[model samples]
Target: MNTTTLLFEAPGPRGRRRCRLFEIISWAVLAGIAYLVIQTLDKRGAFDAAAWQPLGQLGVWRQLGVGLLNNVRAAVVGMLLSMFFGCFLGWGLLSGHKIVRYPCRAFTDLFNGIPVLLLLFFTSLALPAWGLPLTDFWFLVIALSLYSTAVIADLVRAGVQALPRGESEAAAALGFSGLQSMWLILLPQALRMMSPALVSQMVIVFKGTTLAFVLGGYFDLLRAATVLGAYYSRSLLQAQGIAAVAFMLINIALSQTAAAIDRRERRRYGVPPIGTGSRSPGMPE
Candidate 1:
C-alpha cells in the first residue's frame, strides 16, 4: 500500500461502484452543458465557416505570433526585474535592522494587496501625466515587476525559513559578515529549495501579460486578438478561443515544469516521492 493508503482507508468495492456512477453522471451533465452551449452559439452563427476564416489566413497568425513574442518579452523582462528586487526585499524582511524591515514589509503588503490593473494604470498613465512618460512596453513590464516582486519576496523568505537553523548559526560562528554569509551559503541553498515556487510564479507573470490590453500601450497576444476581432467582427469568438488555447498550453507547460522541479527537489532533499510506500524516519505509520 502507498503512503496515502496508509494514511487513509481505501474505498471498498461498493464505494468504487458509487464513484463510477458519480463519474458517469458528471460526464453526462458536462455533455448536456456542452450541447446547450453549442446550440446557443450556433443560433448566433458562431460556427459558420466564414467566422473562422481569419484563422486560416497566414497574416492573422503572423500578427498574433508577433504579439505573442511581445508578451514573452514583457514577461521575461518583468520576471527578471521582480527576481532582482525581490531578493533584496526578501533580505530586508529578514534583516535585523528596523530601518530595513519596516520598509520592506510596507512595500510587500502594499503591492501584494493591490489589483495589478491599478498598477498598470499608474505606470502607463499616471506617470506620463506627472511628466514621466514611459513607453507602453516599459509600462507593462514595470507594472508586472512591481506586482510580482512581493510574491517573489515571500517565496525567498519562505525558502530561507525552511532551512535548518544551524545553517545561519554555522555562518555566524565562522566569523562571516551577514552579507558574506548570505551570498556564500544561505542564498544558494534557499534558491534551490524555492526553485519550484519561483518557476510556478513565472506562470502568473506570463498570464498577467494579458492585462496589457486594458492599458492600451502594449501589443500583447490578447490585444492582437482584440484588434483582429475589431477588424473582423465575425472572427471575434474564434480569435478569443485561439488566444485562450494558447494561454492554456503555455500555463500547462509551466505547471509541468514546476512539478518536475518539485520532484527533483524532493529527491535531492531525501524526501520520499509521492505514491511511494517509503516513509522518512519518525514519520507515523
Candidate 2:
C-alpha cells in the first residue's frame, strides 16, 4: 500500500470522519434545543427581571459552593470505603478455598442486585431504629460503598483472571506462599489492568450521591435544589435550571477527570494512547 493508504487504513480515516461528523451533529441538535427552551422561557416571562431576581439574590456562587461541598464529602468518603472493601472482597474471592470465596461472591452479588436509593433508605431508617448513628450523609456513603464495592470486586477478579498462568506458577516455584504470591506477583498487575474500571465505579458513586435527598438531609445538591424550589414555587423553572446546570457541570468534570486518569494509567503501563500511532495485540507495527 502507498504511504497515504497505509496510514489511512491503519487508523481508518473514514470511521474517524464519520465519528467527528456525528459528534458535531449531536452538539448542534443540543444547542438548537437549548436555544428553543430559553426562548420559550423568555416568552413566558420565566426569565424576566422579577422571575430571575430570586436566583440572582440567592448568590448563585454560595449555593453552588455548598452543593459542591456536600457532593464532594459524600463522594470522597464513599469512594475510599468502596475501594477498601472491594480490595478485601476481591482478595477473598481468589482465596482458593470455597468457604471463603463462595461467601464473598454471594455477598457481593446480593448487594449488587439492590438499587442504591432503596438501600440507602432502608439502611438509614433501619439502622437508626437499631441505635446506629446513621446520618443521611453516612447512610448515603454506606449505600454507595456497598453497591460500588461489589462492582469493583468483579472488576478486580476479571483483572486477576486476565494475567498469564505462568506468573502464578513462577511465584509458586520460587517458594512464595499463597498470600505472598498474591501480594508480590498478582495484585499489582491486576490493579493496573482494572484501573479504568475502578475509575468508572468512582464516577458512578459520585453521581449516586444525588440520591441522598431521600433521607431528608441538606447535604446533597438535589436536596438543596428541592428546598429552593419549594420556597420559590413561582420560580421553579429557574431553580430547576440551576440544579440541572450544577449536575451537568459535576458530571462533565467527573468524566473528564476519569478520562485523564485512564490516559495516565494507560501510559504508565506502556499501552499506546487511543487514536494515536499505536499497535494493538496481534497487529503489525
Candidate 3:
C-alpha cells in the first residue's frame, strides 16, 4: 500500500478571476442605470439653470437652516430623554423580579407596536384635551422619545443577556450585592456592547423628526422643502432636491458621530482590532 499526501489550497487564480468579473459586471450595471437616469433628467430639463435656481437662492439656505435647527433641537432632546427612559426600563426588565420586569416588557412591547405617526398625532391632539400643555414640537419630541426608547430598551436587554454568567457568579462569590454587581460589573460591559445599537436608534430618532410635519409645524426639513416648493409654484423636483440634500447632510453627520463613538468604545475597552488576532488596545489581559 502506498500513501500520498494531497495539499489543500485556498481559492486560487480562477476564483479571483470570477470575483473580479462579477465586480466588473455589477459596476457596469450600476453605471448604465446612472447614465439612463441622467439622460432622462436631462430630457426633462431637470438639470437646467432655471430649474435649479431655487437651490441657488440664498433664502433657500436660510430657510433650510431654520428648519434644520428646529429638527436638530427636537432630535437631541428626544434622544437624550429616550436614552434615560431606555436605561431605566432596561434595568427594570432585568431586575430579576417578575413585577418589575413584566410591566417594563409590556410597555416596551406596546410602544414598539405602535406606528410613529399615530403616536405623534395622539400626543399632539389627544393629550391636549387632558390639559397636557404640549406644543406641536414638544408633542412630537415626546412621541419620538417614547418610540425610540422602546427600541433602545430592547438593545439594552440584549446587551445584558449577552454578558457572561460567570461575571455574576464571581460577583456573588465576592459577596457583592446584586445592585453592586449590576451597576459595577454588568452594566458597564453591557453599555459598551449596546453603543452601536444606541447610535442606530439615535439615527432613527433624528430621521423621525420629519414626522413633525403631521403636528402642523413647519419645523422640519420636509416641511421647509414643501414650503420652498410652494413658493416655486409646486415644483416637486425642487422640493425633493432640497429634502435630499438636507437628509444627506444629516445622515452624514450622524454616521460620522457613530463612527467616532465606535472608535472611542474600542479604545476604552481595549478591544482587539477588527480582523486582527491581537488583543484590543484597552482590554484586560
Clashing pairs in 3: 270-280, 270-282, 270-283, 271-280, 272-280
Query: In model 2, where do residues sit more than 4 Å from their true spots?
Result: 1-40, 58-60, 267-279, 283-285
**Candidate 1 lDDT tens digits, 223-271:** 9999999999999988888889989999999989878887787778865
CA shift of 36, model 1, Å: 1.5
Ranking by TM-score: 1, 2, 3
> Which regions of candidate 1 deviate over 4 angstroms?
5-22, 272-285
* Cα lDDT listed for each candidate: 0.86, 0.77, 0.80
**Residue lDDT tens for model 3, 13-124:** 9998998999999999999999999999889887777777777779888987888888889999999999888878988888889999999999999999999998988898
Give all TM-scores, in the order shown: 0.88, 0.78, 0.76
Query: What's the lDDT for residue 14 in model 3?
Result: 95
For candidate 2, the per-residue lDDT at 243 reads: 75
Regions of model 3 farther than 4 Å from truth: 1-36, 164-177, 180-185, 234-236, 267-285
Model 1 pairs whose backbones collide:
none
Error of 2 at 2 (Å): 15
